[model samples]
Target: MSQQVGVVTFPGSNGDHDAWNAFANDLGVPTRMVDYRETDLDGIAVVVVPGGFSYGDYLRCGAIARFAPVMNAVREFAQRGGPVLGICNGFQVLTEAHLLPGALLRNESLRFHCDWIHVKVENRSFWTSDVEVGDILRLPIAHGDGSYFADDETIARLESNGQVIFRYCDANGAVLDNANPNGSRRAIAGIANEGRNVVGLMPHPERATDPLVGGADGRRIVTAALSALQVAV
Candidate 1:
């Protein structure tokens, strides 16, 4: 009996199916699409909030979607120590929900950036237990408001508590300003809650699950999460 994954799909979300395929087909895991209007999360061991322009990206990247009914359930799930993974726009939503710290601001470049990028693992969390710190992962990012911003106090807390889970880096594992595509503070690419059960990132791991598209580094994340949970994959 494998733990089932729930991928939430809000209106205007475009990456729900992609995430579903990654888990259900590529990772050989069971998945259910939790609807936006539904406030149920029974039997979902893990919740995935995939990337997309939710609610037409109005007001802010995730401000509107944060009020969705499904997110309320996801928030409850996270509070109960359930694992949650948010990618791209999903990351924005997590921030809006306050499940993860820091806010995603408009890119300094003031333009949408869509490209394959490298992010170094900064700390291990529930979803990244199989990966070690300093490990560089290749993935894709697409967003206009992906820059991460946090108050000094919050930044200090995240740094001291090891909540910063991912940082942009080069191939040789060097964190450099040039490698930061979104101009996020300290090149932060991802983060985890204090409990480490909830994680949020701006890159699209769901897009890199197959080598046919590019590389398979994304599959490593899926494998790591399932393995960490003692779920057979």
Candidate 2:
């Protein structure tokens, strides 16, 4: 069975330790911090790219982090069917790496958002496997460029392929304009790659793992991924 999770840390990754705490400390799972300068992922079971303004968000969020030496290993790991989860800025990095499709533009409101939101599960893939479709997940999002955009063709493709994994929705799971916090297209908050192993989302799941912090819904996502990967804690 898979053993340890690897959390990648870029120059400005503020959430690396948060993620490490979630898996290693909170979840009681083993974890390692993968430095961006390192080009290897030797024994890592699952990979997580946490959030932050990598490379100072230079050029664009995740643009520079996409070229980090560690990302090359991540790409290779994905090619080997490894499960990879990217959160917030990590999501941006995956898109910039072409590991996923589309781009995240500035929020439609043009303001940074740091709020709790609801998302409905659209598919059972990788990081979202344990959640049933249409289930409402309450997670926190913190990003200035979380708006998801893609050409109509690409959007349609993702929709038809069931690549859309999470969509902004009301607390009761109703997808509506007001619930679309970042104005993401079709309210998409997360998605999976064609392989269904690479997943990225604009929410911060690691932060919600403990009750003291708020809710434990993010714990659901993490444990779900671990369960799906059959990685015992």
Candidate 3:
């Protein structure tokens, strides 16, 4: 049976449809569009917080959305070891909600970045288990506040725990300053929780799942999540 995925839709979310298309249409998985006001997550095997300027990004990127009724359920779900993937602005929300470590600051360029970039898989997580370490993926990123930041001690902990799942890199998997799109510390692009079930990233993997749109590298992530959920069942 196909895994049932839930895609959260905040008031300002713009990537919910894209995520639904990727998982439901392209991957042939069942999907539910969850509203921010909903308080239940009964049948969801996996939850995806898609990218967008939630609450107009008023009081910090995800500060407002963190208090939504649905987020309480999301937090509880994640605490129970459920798989949760946050993309782009969704990543910011996860940080603000304290579901993940680190914060996302404005791009060093002080501008919105929307383009394709390469990211190297650094560790295995539910979202990255299908891809091998050092494998480079072509993914599109669109965000204004995508620079990942954390205290030195927290960074060290994340590194030591193998929680830094992906880092910005060149096609050859070389981490380079020029390849860093948002001046993220250590060129980090994505991370997972200690359990490796919760993940947050600044790139839009759902946007790169279809060949007609661009590349299909992102299919690996969606597929991996499905595989993990199946194995858990």
* Whole-model lDDT per candidate: 0.89, 0.90, 0.92
User: TM-score of model 2 relative to the true fold?
Assistant: 0.96
What stretches of model 3 exceed 4 Å from their correct place?
1-3, 228-233
Error of 1 at 124 (Å): 1.1
User: Better model by lDDT, 2 or 3?
Assistant: 3
Q: Assess candidate 1 and give its TM-score to the true structure.
A: 0.96
Better of 1 and 3 by TM-score: 3
Give a tens-digit lDDT track for model 1, residues 70-147. Answer: 887899989988889999999999999899998999999999999999999999898788678878899998899999
Task: Give candidate 2 misplaced runs (Cα > 4 Å).
Answer: 228-233
RMSD to the hidden true structure, all candidates: 1.7, 1.6, 1.4
Tens-place lDDT per residue, model 3, 51-145, is 99999999899999999999999999999998999999999999999999999999999989999999999999989878999899999999999
Give the per-residue Cα lDDT of candidate 1 at 161: 97
- Model 2 lDDT at residue 190: 94
The digit string of per-residue lDDT tens for model 2 on 1-233 reads: 34789999999999999999999988887788999999888778889999999999999999999988898899999988889999999999999999999999999999999999999989878787667887888889999999999999999999999999999999998899999988999999999999999999999989999988988889878875566335533
Best by lDDT: 3
Clash pairs, candidate 3, are: none
